[model samples]
Target: MKILQDFELLFQQELHKLYDNDEIKAIFLVVIAEKLGLNTANYQLSKKDPVDDKNSAEILSILRDLKKHKPIQYILNKADFYGEVFQVNESVLIPRQETEELVDLIIKNHKFSQNLNIIDIGTGSGCIPITLSKHLTNARVTTIDISKEAIKTAQENANILKTAVQFINADIFEWEYIFSNQHYHIIVSNPPYITPGEKKYMNENVLAYEPELALFIEESTPLIFYDVISSFALKHLAPDGDLYFEINQYLGAEMKDLMIKKGFEQVKLIKDINGADRIIHAKKAW
Candidate 1:
């Protein structure tokens, strides 16, 4: 393992125990490229590049953590969302590609206009609002999270992304009381929609490392956030305001019906790249 190329075989062997051969290779390649400051193309060209004793030990240590099911994003403390990098830790859920689809959906459907107000509920990592602020330049964006730590992390990410997103540290359930005057032209959330019963189906890394508060809900009321937020929109959203959600894959029809019952119009459920129901788009038809 003294040579960088020499570690490849051993790393793949270790990762193969937990991941498919393709994924193991992909992960190893990414880690090596990042650690060695080589692009994938260059790394493939320099497979024989040597690793010093210190660097070899560091690589092995990281591999050990990976073997224990630590998420690679947490290992690097960064995730790419919507063509931008967001800082993430265990306090917040790592921004996923599906969530990027959620963001893209909003960006595609809504044209950013002057004074457009947007608020994101449960702003984990602030990825949604921050990205919206970055691209929706004239939109005044604010994001709320129940966890102060998550708010702080979101603030840091906002700063890094050079986006002016107001980070509010209050439970969304209490938002009506705390910021009753606040209303929005757009409201979005990628809230905790996973049911407690579904924990058995989650990945080892997600269950072991990601914050549970940002992941799960009571099995009896898996759509608690959606119910509350969509209802809130009935009173708070401006005329023709849009409401977006990254929903549980299992709840598309339920979400559409919920929004419609709450009086939202044009309620649409969208599938992710995998064709699983993952996003819902609806509007207040004032």
Candidate 2:
């Protein structure tokens, strides 16, 4: 029970029923790396070393939460996103790999531009805007969120990353009142696109542990966030600017059609690594 190897065995014994072998190992390794600062090589080298009573207590506490299907990131209060770690809580959704692709796409498309102005809607953990600010030093970034708690957590992340992303507490639906005349060269968002009906297909850990406010939309309005943000972009984006979104896989064609109907000069639907229709880029005409 005191040895690091014993803790690894404990994870397997406890979580084997809940997770597959690879998932169990990945979760155990992440917990060990963060909680004990041991990488896989070092973990293997020191697996038999006795852990202190305090560390053992902490591991047990985390294991208890894992039993309840709590996300490891929330249990540790941090998440890995776009090559950096961000603070996370139930108030905000954990960053995802699809979002990283969205950020990478923006960086690739805008890296050469000078003095870019970009804004991100729905700033959960501030990952999108903050990562953009870090990579695109010439850009001024603004991010908005409806939840004050999400803003607070995201602000902490921005501060930690030392990225100058302006965090605003506002609803995207009311952005016109807040930023009537201001224009951005790039507008991006990874807003809530999960329909309530789709919840049945998602894993229990996500459905039970993650924040519903940042995940689900009414089935009646599957495009609520996308509908509002993209429309707002048509008004607030500068001439020749671009709008980007991480979209629902099922609604890719519909989203592309919506962007085209909104009169974007060019609309490109891009797939994620998993080949899901995951991102959209809509360019405004000059």
Candidate 3:
């Protein structure tokens, strides 16, 4: 069996073409640390130790999966969002850094507010609602997802994270009636906005490993979720309540117009680190 340091070199040699040198190194360290039951602090001291045969097999399997472009998060079955670690799997889309920005923006907007009611429409990994529940301490957070498997994964994350979020396993269209007489201080969604045609442009890691239902919108109705969720917010949002979305970068202008047409005020499109229009915010008139 190879020493841990040698496996690091192997990881770099095999993954260099697909990942940057820095990212590959980071992944290598994390995989070794997790696999060997060592934390970051002790990692350097253990690098020269020879890995046992069984552990070596697991490392080799991970390398093979990496070569196939499967995300490291899926391989590990865990993801970090905001400041919390969340369980993840093939059933749910991995929590993204861009979505963290969306959650942070909402927290900043309502940081001092209390007893708010917040409902998120897409409950992948329960990251959004769970993070909101943790930060906005007095808020009642509820989330919905169309996929039962996704809801199960999100619930598992919520339990693991020790956050209470009411989860609903229902399509937004079928479940609107359940909230007809209800109103919320905020409604948020990181819905499926990528059109079918855009799949070719997405990373193989995302397309091949992630759930398609959480990634693509129908080509004929590319903005289906945004349109429906924004319209739902029109009626279900409390007076002066806010609505937020993690949107397609290419569709920001269209999103702003749609929210305006839905009569939401103060519509704004915000850019992510890559300067892509990634989040949208709108407020209902008080």
Please give the CA lDDT of all the candidate structures: 0.86, 0.90, 0.90
Using alpha carbons, what is the TM-score of model 3? 0.95
Tell me how far candidate 1 lies from the true structure as C-alpha RMSD in angstroms.
Answer: 1.3
RMSD (Cα, Å) for all candidates, in order, is: 1.3, 1.2, 1.4
TM-score (C-alpha) between model 2 and the true structure:
0.96
Over the stretch 147-231, how does candidate 3's per-residue lDDT look in tens digits?
Answer: 9999999888888888889999998877877887889999999998889888888888998999999998788887889888988
Compute the lDDT for candidate 1: 0.86
At residue 39, candidate 2 shows an lDDT of 95
Each model's TM-score, in the order given? 0.96, 0.96, 0.95
The better-scoring model by TM-score among 1 and 3 is 1
Query: What C-alpha lDDT, on a 0 to 100 scale, does residue 19 get in candidate 2?
Result: 91
Question: How does candidate 2 score on lDDT?
Answer: 0.90
lDDT (tens digit, per residue) of candidate 1 on 1-286: 3666778788778877678888877778778867787777887778887887877887888898999999888998888889888889999999988999998988877754667899899999998998888877588998899999899999998888788888889887777886678788899999999998888888899999999999999999888999999888888898888899999999988988888888888988899999999999888877
Clashes (candidate 2): 0
